[model samples]
Target: MFFDRKELTNDQLVTFYRQILLPRMIEEKMLVLLRQGKISKWFSGIGQEAIAVGAALAMQEDEWLLPLHRNLGVFTSRKMPLHKLFLQWQGHPEGYSKGRERSFHFGSKAHHICGMISHLGPQLAIADGIALAHLLAGEEKASLVFTGEGGTSEGDFHEALNVAAVWNLPVIFVIENNGYGLSTPVEEQYRCSQLVDRAKGYGMEGVRIDGNNLLTVYDTIRGVREYCVREKKPYLIECMTFRMRGHEEASGTKYVPAQLFETWGRKDPVVLFENWLMSQAILDADGVERERQRIRATIEEELQLAGAAGPADFTFQDEIADVYAPASEITGEIPGSDRELRFIDAIKEALDEALQTHENLILMGQDIGAYGGAFKITDGLADKYGVARVRNTPLCESAILGAALGLSLEGYKAMVEMQFADFVSVGFNQIVNNLAKLHYRWGQSADVVVRLPTGAGVGAGPFHSQSNEAWFTHVPGLKVVYPSSPQDAKGLLLAAFADPNPVLFFEHKALYRSITGIVPDTAYQIPIGKARQVHQGNDISIITYGAGVHWALEFATAHMEIGLDIVDLRTLQPLDYDAIRQSVMRTGKVIVLHEDTLTGGFGGEIAAWIGEHCFEYLDAPVTRCAALDTPVPFNTTLETQFLPKARLREAIQRLVSY
Candidate 1:
């Protein structure tokens, strides 16, 4: 629970009143515009202005804010220009997202605010990362994140609170209990007596407060901040308030009983604050009207300027633009030592070198610290860099990934290792929706490298053995790197760290110690979206990656008379189409092979592209070899048959014979 609030000065009281009044007036005017068909939509924080206004004013400007749909006061209280916010609201070019997104879905780094995704729970975990940055830098700053009462039910909410409590992050988790999550009542949302009580479960302090009282809000939050910065811990504040309007202006509030409004209406935050100011003789009725007029006139001027900026003109090409950072001019191979290292050791060497090279690098995952992770990839590195750099995380994959994105926002690069590639399913929302879309939607770089120990040779069963790269390759704004051999593994992992987007680095679980190759002693980079020719004969080409690369090379080596050309597609995304085309054109026949299942595999994509582009040159139909459409089996014999190992020879014979 928060400490007792000290009395506020007259100036502080007046400032709070004015800040609370500003959002109320702006929302009121926006309602008129909404009716008149100017603004498209609005999430009215009409009666609950004090929660946003008071919270924003109480926190330092240096602290970051993760705000949701209805918190209009956060933008205004931060002194973000009304005109630009209006442009953002109107989907114009001058806005933060440059009309790439609408509503409050854009963050302003200058104002120290990260916008919320529609999936509200993920932001809770992201706030942990922002607070982690403060902890890393030894700064007093904390991160404040808000979620509705309904959001507390999300898995990310639990993950976030648990992580924050475990790590002792300075995050002020504010839950705005506005009586409804859309149409569902609060009673249906939870069985707990109060949302703030959840803090006890996470081993943190919490307090419920009168959100309608502007003075209480300002003082309580100020005290909460002081306690957070001093104690270096998490605290929850449930602001007890009611929505004065529908969830959005488009959604009517008929579900809300009329009597309920009458009760909550009397406790209106703006009127409560205004009456307090008048009774104290700090302001009068005339002054109130004069202040409203002053704000109203300012709103009009800002609106005119915003409207004058006109709409954002975007073409189809513009939609594709800014989807990724400038493609790395860094291309070609990494020269290596004669010393042979296992695939896993090569990756470990790259990470160890990276920790020494960059100070802002952070490694987070389950058992990744002193325990050295599930596969020992992080072995002894935590001992060298300390657990601060090579950090261990909870079972909450979604929260950890969100935190990685947040850490990136704070000038830090984070590499999160999913113990198994299959576990990425638990955190897909953060990977695809949050990290993959952050830069294109808001121009914020999400420099995260997630090392996914992937593929299906370990007989780890259905849950553990998975080739999930195809799922991510379909998602734009992500770089998917899947390398084969010790050399490419070391080189590409370094390249993944350099690229300014979220990258999925897939490492085969079986290849860790089974295969060894020449690897560079120090750090190096291989160009992503490039391929290498493993075998030179041009009679027929086998396009492959990951475990498939080894499979194809062995088959080509054994069948010397077949005249096979094996092209290793080290990077799955931004596919080395030029290399693919070159192979297809030279051989006049091609086979796409992968460790994943046959249907909807990356093999299907390569085959489709070859058919579409190189049909004229292809002497035969482009063939594909992949595992059967079933879960990876537990038995080694069943798994071997389930994989493409047996199917590749048949695929090669067909393509070569044709």
Candidate 2:
């Protein structure tokens, strides 16, 4: 409780007293409000105010902070508006997430605070991303992240720390060992004697400090921050603190031993700081009460403004509008087509152009540097653009994805390639939870393009080959681009990179080198949602995208007398419904073809859309030609039968006759 650490001036000592008291006082009032049924919930950082407050005073204003839900001291110390902070708790429109998110789960770009989400661990890697951005921009800024002892057990913790150490990124990994992780004690969390001990495994120094001591937290963090920036390396620190209240008011701390509150009460951050302040002659007993009253009055005034905002205004249209950004307005000049290139070459061409054109462009993935990539799609890119721009990452997809999100926050265009589409499952949380919901929750553009080497044909089997585009189309706030040809692949990729949203650009491995088409010599943006009519006919229409387009084209050419029409729906999320309606209306019969298996495949979506919108125009029920509902097999014979290629002809003939 008492610190004999770094010496401070009179005003500095007084400042620490006020900073530590602020969150403690505010949290107490909110708990009262919760008991009175005025507020829904509260995550109390009551006993551990010093760590958050001290870190706030320690880090530079420009330095990025990724704090957990309970660290209200960081917000108040950063001078975040108390009115809006209260509004966030009240779920008012003026809150950080505009009332879209509950609790202190929102961050302020203005304040440079990146709040931790409910999932908790991914933000550690996200902090790495912010630090990585600073490193790339040649800024000496460091990123500080807070995690509880339990959070250290997550795989992201290991990935983030290793990545930071390897890249020499400026990041301060602060573990607030709050003893219990939602009632699971620290002893149960890890077998290690202390969380700081893991730092050596990542080739970094780790320090332990008294989290309850206000002066110690500030002094330790300030010193470590200097070291991080000077050396451009990561440092780990463990703040020994205790959670005074339950994780949330709703979940009572009955599971916590009663003696902990008594024992830790002696080491209370506020009580210790207040006694230390009185010893410094900053305040007496009466002065302490007056200071508390003064802070309470300030909170009350801010609460009035926050309460005036009323409940959040909810509208169905606003919900839909916030899901994804609208189509890009100005799509730059469309250059003429000049050369025929393979699908892989076209994608590489787009990446090459992006690196040349975008100064802040960065390419990150596993084996993407000198060795190129698993398929060599990024071959020679590292040679052309330096290794820094075309970077290889550890086999940690979640961390890399989070880093890309962080870079995007720093106004950089990041392109991340997943070795295989199925491998994306490893980083699925970063995509579906963070990347997909970042803008919709906090109004920040995640301008990242995730290149997916997808589809099944070359017997790469389950892990390597899978048509996983449908997996992302189901999630909002992400644009799903699955181009059919080398030409479309190049234009769509360039367009995906230019668009201000999270995009999953699915590159079918089966077509990457096998297919070649005329591509533009100069980079051009093809509007994402637009579809192109591949073949014109009258009787039956085949609508598809990705590998299915090639099969449909072959069939269209082979059975020219059957009068078949083919349409390639380029982007899945912002589907070209107009094109779909027109095609179904003209042909009267439709066959939705796709490489993904039946049942949950995207073909069902298109067929359902046709049934819903073009019911009257249809001469027969909409048919579907898709792979069997099973994982792609290794055997070529079975793989051929599993795909829609074998079924396309039968489906088209049946639809034409019907």
Score each candidate by Cα lDDT.
0.89, 0.88
Off by over 4 Å in 1: 1-7, 331-333
**TM-score of candidate 1 against the unseen true structure:** 0.97
Residue 139 local lDDT, model 2? 90
Task: Predict model 1's lDDT versus the native.
Answer: 0.89
- Candidate with top lDDT is 1
Clashes of each: 0, 0
C-alpha TM-scores of all predictions: 0.97, 0.98
Error of model 2, residue 123, in angstroms:
0.3
Clashing pairs in 1: none
Scored by Cα lDDT, where does model 2 land?
0.88
lDDT of 1 by residue, 262-294 (tens): 999999888877887788787899988898888
Residues 363-385, candidate 2: write the lDDT tens digits: 99999999989999899999998
